[model samples]
Target: KKVELVTQGEATELDKSLVEKITDPLTHLVRNSCDHGIEMPADRIAKGKPETGTITLVASHQGGSIVIEVRDDGRGLNREKLIKKAREKGIDAPDTMTDAEVWNLIFAPG
Candidate 1:
């Protein structure tokens, strides 16, 4: 039910620093998720979901750190494609790693 012009990060009483650090990165991440991460209407329909898939961005305080999660029910990360692409770039990834770890590896410096 919240609405605003800028659509930037929100802040709780203890979130001043967190709000600053996450605002720009969060904006870019949301833009990327909407533009590239989520599938198109036809793709969603083919995958057995509704035409418009929902993207949820949540922020909360978890102990000493703030936790933010950007999630969508659309297609998750494609592990095989990522591994193949990484291997093409000569990055060695251990097979014992999980998809979540592999996803972070995509953000690592090459």
Candidate 2:
């Protein structure tokens, strides 16, 4: 039996058209997470963490807006390479911004 571990909003609130379009993209993201994000069994053992890594999906309503989150205890964003790439692309990423802001540069188009 499948059980919903947690949810805080109406899952049906999603726009039907957009939902249908994004379903495959969402599935691909989850599958990619399983394949590339989560470490292998042997690697986890070597790292001294649990053999099986965990991926969590969260949904909620906040300030009258829906929120969806997919998270994992895996390798996180690479900041150094991101900043270097930004410079290479001629993006003037001021040093005042935080690491999180620098990381967002990766999403910016060339």
lDDT of 2 by residue, 2-98 (tens): 1122233446377779679877866775665676677777777788867777767666667877677766666666677777788889998776769
Model 1 TM-score on a 0 to 1 scale: 0.72
Candidate 1 local lDDT, residue 99? 81
Off by over 4 Å in 1: 1-11, 94-97
Question: In candidate 1, what are the lDDT values of residues 1-80, reduced to their tens digit?
Answer: 11112222356344478669878987877666776667888887888877776667766667877677776665777787
Report the lDDT of model 1 for residue 32.
65
Which prediction has the highest TM-score against the true structure? 1
Which segments of model 2 are wrong by more than 4 Å? 1-13, 88-90, 93-97
- In model 2, the clashing pairs are none
